[model samples]
Target chain A: MSRQQRHDARVPIALAVLGWLAVAFFVLPIMALVLRVPWSSLSDVITDDATTEALTLSVFTSVITTVLAIVLGVPLAWLLARSNIPGRQFIRALCTLSMVLPPVVAGVALLASLGRRGVVGEILDDWFGVRLPFTMPAVVIAQLFVAMPFLVLTVESGFARSAGTVEEAARTLGASPWYVFTRVTLPATQPAIVAGAVLTWARALGEFGATITFAGNFPGTTRTLPIATYLALESDIDDALLISMVMVVISVVILVALRGRWVGAIGGMR
Target chain B: MGWRNWGYEVSLSIDVKRRIGATQLNVQFTVAIGETVAIVGPNGAGKTSLLRVVAGLISADEGRISWDGMVWDDASSGEFSPPEQRPLAYVFQDYALIEHLTVGDNVAFGLRARGVRRRRARERAQEVLDVVGGSDLVERMPSSLSGGEAQTVAIARALATEPTVMLFDEPFAALDASARAHARRLFSSMRSLSMARLIVTHDAVEALTLADRIVVVESGSVVQIGTPSEVLATPRSHFVAEILGLNPLSGQLRGDELSLGAMSLTVGAHGVDDGEVIAIVRPRSVSLHRERPEGSPRNVWRTTVEAVDRSDGRVRVQLGAPLPIAVEVTPAGFDALATELDGDVWASVKASEIVVQPA
Candidate 1:
């Protein structure tokens, strides 16, 4: 053996053994779930009224939440990435801080700001006779509050890495400011945007803590798939696993279809 | 040479001041319609900065740019026209074609920006592409094009705009020698067009070959402006002299004698009393000999060969010590001399061949 190889081989083997043990420790739980799948009664478990309603509600709310994130979040991403406004770093940090917060804290924070007796909610109720808490829209609001940060941060990094010179060349060719943004800037960063939308949709679908704390668990009103999974755990554990399995399947399909290249491109941005 | 016999009227006047770090650019010049002006200058002498200011890539500190009674920039009132609104076409050094677009779409970009229909824009773009000899490249992507093909598409895109004025900043700089010849032919065709042209280049050949007039700049200022012949026969500054392939020597003038440091030379004169004068002589004007020639040439010096560099099928022999000079000799003449490194030689030059300019 070469001298350097022999020198490196002098190190103990315990750490390598411990590293593989750690990998097995992390992979073992997913293996256990797949092993005990309860496959025969899966369809019967999922077709029940509460299960179907929660499943459909998740697909509905998450899709709507993702659409809202794109409509509202892309402009904010562009502003954060391109504008020379002062204290932009601080503003960006504030956005990141909210994403890292516990979901229960986000739910409580949303309730304090928009609940019936809350600060803005009281004025809103007095003036417009409108209420937001414990409603279906409240679930969407909670999910959006927790999920939009993923979209905003991802799209912002894409815009940051885009070539600003192409935009200048476009303007010199007589393209207006808005046309350049839509034609040059937006298309150049489409991969990040697609990856971000998928991430946001997935996060909204799996949102449980904020939705439960703020929107509550009424039967057909606010119970989403994750909420249904939580309620089913107390009575029927098999039904809960069936709904969880559906969630896992749908997430895998969406990720596999969108995951080939977008994730790899944004890998450098991270 | 003195702005005499000019047939065209001035259409563009740029009188602007800008500061980039320690260098301050303060230039004032004009371009005539139906005439092409080439800017030749040393690197970092504000040649590209002058074009960028005119193109509105950067704003100037003071002054204004006026073209045919239209005000482009007036700094005192903070009035400025952005690059998009100007009716000038700029072909950048790298072409800057958008990578995601097809060649036809890239050329059609300007037309589409003005609300032209997509089908009609591509048709118009195709017509111009044919003029530049790149009609077959319309269906190709910009990333797949060679340097010369991209340059042709860039010029085609600019031509589609039908601009009133045009600016090209070293358009041939990115191409190979063979490609440059093709680009040169395409550029010479632009002479028939009525648009005002200002081309910035460091190569004297491009200026003399393509430009109707040349403007020489130094240290962010316009040092001289003249036709190609005038610039060659009499360069006003040493920088322009060196750029035109001439060796320049400056000294004090006293009656018929030009005193350069410890050396003096007799000159035939229609003369001034006494002042600083610069005499420039091309390499072809100096002739080399093994011993002092038996002719009546006024300037002759015995020297040793320092270096011999060959280019363009000719040898440039560098003579050493006491006014070291370069002499361009033909291949047959070089064979006759059989010049070698560190060899002794005598150089001779006629007094009438020197160009003297007041400093």
Candidate 2:
């Protein structure tokens, strides 16, 4: 064996200890929730009308948010990937701004634009008599605002990678521009699109600070899983832990299914 | 290789000026209907750029490209039809078949783009796949196919649109020798089906064997256009000669004596007097010896062998010394010479083998 290989197996003791503690630091919360399941009344806590209402609202809002993200994000991804519009850099920066900003800040920004008596919101109230905040649709908007950049950025990179000579070849074969995009570009980037969708869905399901701040957490309307967990924490700690366990389980299952490569793809896309 | 365009009329005329990065392409060429032209050039010689412009992927700065009396691009009139409106098909080197699509669907992409119904498109795709003799691959995904299979699917896809003109850029460069040979045999059958074909390749043998007319491009310009035999027998430039495995030496020529490097080579009579000239020696005429010949000197030079490349069942030895020259030899002949890489050897050429061109 080489001299380097002989010494490579030994690691510093303090590093080993600290590394174990780091794993425990992130993993212990889920362990705590699992240990504190309160198995006796688990059914009561899980099937309560309020719990079901919040769970249904979470599913509905997150699903709509994901659909909305795909609808708006794919075209945005295409435009950013393929077109040479003026000020595209600025536009891309704006699209990705939510990814780096705190979720609460995105909530405030959305409120400022779409809330009653807030900039465009005030104009919207005056001109069209529309009040967006504290509505079911506002719940979707809050989740979408914080989650869209994941989809857009991931799919944009996919578009960039696929927008090459194939698209040109498709065009040369008498494919209309729209046909080329749908037939060649979209199919080529399908893996990235699916990966982006999974990320968007996961992010939307966990949206809390934004939904609470902008959508105003009503039990059946805007109290998504994260917001419901937060509310239960203040009133009933066991109930909160149960909701936390549920969130943890779902996130774990989804993320475990995706494993490393796809998450790395999304992270790299970001 | 033997197809003739004698009675056919010119269908595609490209006289365009384009600038790609620092290299500007100012080229003029035409291909008659039923004529397949092979564009051979070094890398970055704007061969692909010329094809792209002709295929309508890029517009010219100022010129006209018309096919079948319809102007595809006329910069003077500010008129340019985008690629989808043009009746042409381009197959890129990478094949560009969609992995998500079955071979059948990939081939049907163009028909769908033209608003054909699903059943009709699939049937048409099958028909074209049959034309390429790849109907068995119809249900297969592009991911499952080999490089050769993907290329056949790409061609089937291109032909599904029934385009009048087809442009291929290094279509066989990605394949192994056997696959390339198979693809070549399949592609030669296309000569009877295609109205016009322009292929960009750096392989001289491919250019010689596949094209009815060969256009030699260098520095983004058309340097020569002739039959394959004409270009192979009389390559115009050092680049073309080197690519075609011809020994090209540029030097000063006075009367019948040509000064090449430190050695003077005797040549047949040439009309050029006391000026720079390029002398070509066919590789077959170049003889190699393990040691100096008994004679004092002729066109013999002691050189070192650099590399040996075998193609088309013939071995070519690259010799580097006073000049780097490619010499063709049979495998048996090379074995008889017993040459090793970087070993010293003597090369001799006959005066009758040299052809002089005014430089």
Best by DockQ: 2
lDDT of 2 by residue, B1-359 (tens): 12234554658998999999988999888898789999998889999999899988899998999987789999999899999999888998898877678999889988888889999999999999888879899999988999888898999999998888999999878886456655766676787885799999986656765788999988898899999668868879976776567655789998888988777888754334578976767788888887887874777888899999987789989889776888888898888888799988888887656766555
Task: Point to the candidate with the largest lDDT.
Answer: 2
lDDT of 2 by residue, A107-218 (tens): 8888989999788899988999989999999999988888998889888888877777778877887888888877778887888888888889999999888888899978
Pairs with backbone N, CA or C atoms under 3 Å apart (clashes), candidate 2: none
Chain A TM-scores, candidates in order? 0.91, 0.91
lDDT of 1 by residue, B1-359 (tens): 33424653648889999987767889988887778899988878888888888888788899999777678888998888887888888888888888788999999998898899999999999999999999999999999999999999989988888877888888767887557767877877888888889999876656766788999988888888999779978888877765557666778877767777746666543223478976656688788887789966567777889998887799888878776667788878877887689988888776655544454
lDDT at A142, model 1: 88
CA lDDT of B316 in candidate 2? Answer: 88
Ten residues in a row with the worst lDDT in model 1 chain B?
B264-273
